[model samples]
Target: MSDFDIKSFLTTLTQRAGVYRMYAADDELLYVGKAKNLKNRVSSYFRARGLNAKTVALVSHIHHIEVTVTASEAEALLLEQTLIKQHRPQYNILLKDDKSYPYLHLSDHNYPLLAYRRGKKRKSGRYFGPYPNATAVRESLNYLQRLFLLRNCEDSYFNHRSRPCLQYEIKRCSAPCVGHISQQGYDDSVRQATLFLQGKAAELLRELQQTMMAASEALEFERAAALRDQIELLRQIQEKQFVDSGQGEADVWAMTDWQNVLCIHRLVFRQGRLLASKNYYPRNPAGDDDTELLAGFIAQFYLADHAQEGVPKEVVAELPAETMEPITEALRLSIGRRVSHSRGQRGQNRKWLVMAQENARTGAQAQVSGRQESARKLEEVKQLLHLSDAPARIECFDISHAQGEATYASCVVYGAEGLMKDRYRRFSIRDVAAGDDYAALEQATRRHLTRLKEQDDLPGLLLIDGGKGQVARVAEVLEELAISTVALFGISKGETRKSGWEFLWEAGAATPIMPEAHNEGFRLLQWVRDEAHRFAITGHRKARAKSRSQSDLESLEGVGPKRRKELLLYFGSLRNMRGAPKEELEKVPGISKKLAEQIFIQLHGE
Candidate 1:
């Protein structure tokens, strides 16, 4: 499997903390990792217990490696991420996709407008959050606007407004758009808003009290009354937020997983009260135990922009003591302080940690129950379908095409746990006529049958997403492969157009087996059929798009891929090049005056 001489590389590696990059046979990066000792950490991968199914698959494809030695593990951690960004290795557990978390940006203006923002934060504005979800930010923003009469209008809208808008009429804004509130009054409101968002509500309340008292002494009764109303609103907010946890501020991190899929939940707390909670899902975590996962996650997560407000005073987690020590030191170095990172200590700290753990555990248990429920449905399917063997592994096939173009066949697999996403496959129908479903099924079934190396690998039941005609064709192919043990059935959404009531039939059978809408057996069948249909549509659409993109350039006899690529790169896209004049087209590196005219005519010709 592995062509690379890993043992010889092991001899060459030094016992130093550094980053190591692993490459696959095709010189593709499989994984990039950092370790306390390069030799020991890299050596452990060859050990027996360290190999999981995912890692084994990765290891089998390894070709060669590279190394960059760092002075410390922390530096190595930073370098690992840099290399990951550079290569995006298949085996590494990446931080997150490029989809950025949303935040609440308050503009730095005459009357600062608050709005939900997504993307890189600019330097000028005051941003209050890296909130978990849009709903949370919107809920908090809604209340913040109500409690403090701050402007939520756009800068353009505010600058051009002829009069106060509905926000002012609803008493949500101070009408600063039309100068209803003075600059000084608006500044005071913004200052309080800043304090409240900074998790310093008490400090804001005290400042409001002082302002109200001064207004009263100056005989400004109207101003004092308005301040009193604001103070009451702020107090009402505090009363709602004040928790009875009897603990100090700490950010709690807990992990829960099912069947190798893991989710880490982070709860940010202020004054013993939960401020915000966010969940992070790591696709197929590499750690063998909970401790390793916790330690690695702690290192990677804190190093990123996850902790926007710097590090919390205490880092509460349910990690092992051995795992905690080194991670704690790394965290201290990052935070520029000696942070308390421990778990299951005592009192309210324990209570908070336990609560977070419960959240994680409950989340994990839900995953387990969901899978178990699916398994039960499979069991019901076996009994209802009258099969000799349990239908633990079910395979469904579907055909998708448009009249006479871009025909595709999709095979979706389902196991006892649920949908086996990794085992899904799509085949483009070549020999079969474009709209012929029966011929398409026969061709796709033959391709799938050849891949079955062992009897155990064969599906317990085979389902076709058509009537008896399609089922009969698949059965003929199965007979050609001499695979008779696997049961065969056909599923058709009848003319009723309802989902649950599907007609099921055996191979070459005329009569349809009817199952109730609420039956778990019918539900399981429906799930598999729907997945097959979706997979077929996705494959068909992608194929059709590719055909459209390729045929456009390939239609020109003289325009080879190299020349077409050059022209497209210069023009930016096919659509752009269609309108480009021959003069502009000739500007491309490889195009000639004669060739450019031909391409121009080929594209924009009547």
Candidate 2:
């Protein structure tokens, strides 16, 4: 633990009311909190009397503390939520969820129909369930269309129907837009569909069964069979329900708080089937109680889901009754549901809440472990490279060519966890001779150093794939660019062209420093050196292939683009074109006798 000034840091806080954040030396966010009296709450950290274990530990890492004065406690809470999502402070309760939830998109055409989609609202269609998974939502949609006999065809197809399509003949669609069914009958089907999505499955099923029995007594066999099918479809839909609370389409979300972290898991039910589940971990969560944190996550989580019409009919949480009403109304308006929150602790309803909580715990633990592992690997790399600080950013350069022909260079980057491919670059040699290794190296070094000078962010290390020569060239380039601070090294293969045995080049040294056998430094240099070589060789191969293709064409005389392209397409390459006899040359579409002779002479040198 470093010496942190607790009293000095706490003096700025006010009991009046505000939000505050604590940060570590590396700028990692430690925690975010809001209090009625900002000064009083913040002062607790500096107490001569013992503080809670969590507070004591957090205070030890406090190099800097920042604050924002809010007008009221509610304002502070809102700002705190925004910061938690943004910073993901380590010591705060985090809600980890990133998957896009499914939504039922209701098209805004004259006939307004239902469809399933996910993501930000792009078109003017009402979207629903970012269902638990695509499978459940898809099956529900199929059954709904079957039971309601609503048309599934697009508006374009609906408009062009002079006669009924197969959907009508098969009894799956009423075809209202094409006049196959009366407006009143179509409206009834639409109403039934809307009710099913609203979670009134029992009512819809009961009505369909009654209709079927009534039709049978009248001896209308054809109509009776159709009604029976609709009833069966409704029953099938009901069978897929994992937990039916006698309520309709809705989402049940639960959260678990542990080790100052929060995990929020949600299950989406649409058309009586559990459609999908999503888990979110928001960093730096805080509340007066567990219920408050859950309430905060729901509000922030659903606001994004609402615009897409994915809001549920009911939301069940372990939170107290006081917080449920506003959350329910907010969600209800988003997806047009009469949203309700349940607090039943002793039934099948209670089991759903527990299951959701379990999922949250498992998800949060896994995410935290992954983050720790990444951090450890980064630490390992830093120690091995003898870096003054952690190498959060690395730059590797390599040269590629075939005996110096088509020589090109590639620069690649890696940081904290792995490679940053977006920052990778490839350069064509501009001032280097073919087959001249030193000259090609010089050209690449100069261009890369010049660009690095103009860029704001610079790499922590400059890795070259050759021995002392390569390292010295890069150092010279850096010096010329007026940049003298970069840590430069060149890695060259040993006598047998095998790895593990390498030469390390540094500035002002006549010889490279070769590490002892099985040393950590050797392993570190090998990793970076191999990475640079791979990048350079890949670039060189591509350049060489392109040059070989165009050069063959360049050597041919009296052949323009049109004729040369004809020759290439006809014979494939110069070797094939030269092998072709007089008759084969005559068969080419654009080839004249003189032009063919010229090509033959260029190829055969006859």
Q: What is the C-alpha RMSD of each candidate to the true structure, in Å?
A: 23.2, 24.0
- Candidate 1, residue 499: Cα displacement in angstroms equals 0.6
Residue 178 CA displacement from its true place in model 2, Å: 13
Report lDDT per candidate.
Answer: 0.72, 0.65
Q: After superposition, how far is residue 402 of candidate 2 from its true place, in Å?
A: 3.3
Put down candidate 1 lDDT per residue, 263-344, tens digits, no spaces: 6767666655454444566654343676677668877877775686467787888887777788678877876788787684
TM-score of model number 1? 0.37
205-292 per-residue lDDT for model 2 (tens digits) = 6677667668879998888777766655565455422332334565678777533346777765555443344566666423356677
**Model 2: what TM-score?**
0.33
**Residue-level error in angstroms, candidate 1, position 438:** 1.0
Each prediction's total of clashing residue pairs, residues at least 3 apart in sequence or on different chains, is 0, 36
Give the residue spans of candidate 1 off by over 4 A: 1-371, 453-456, 550-606
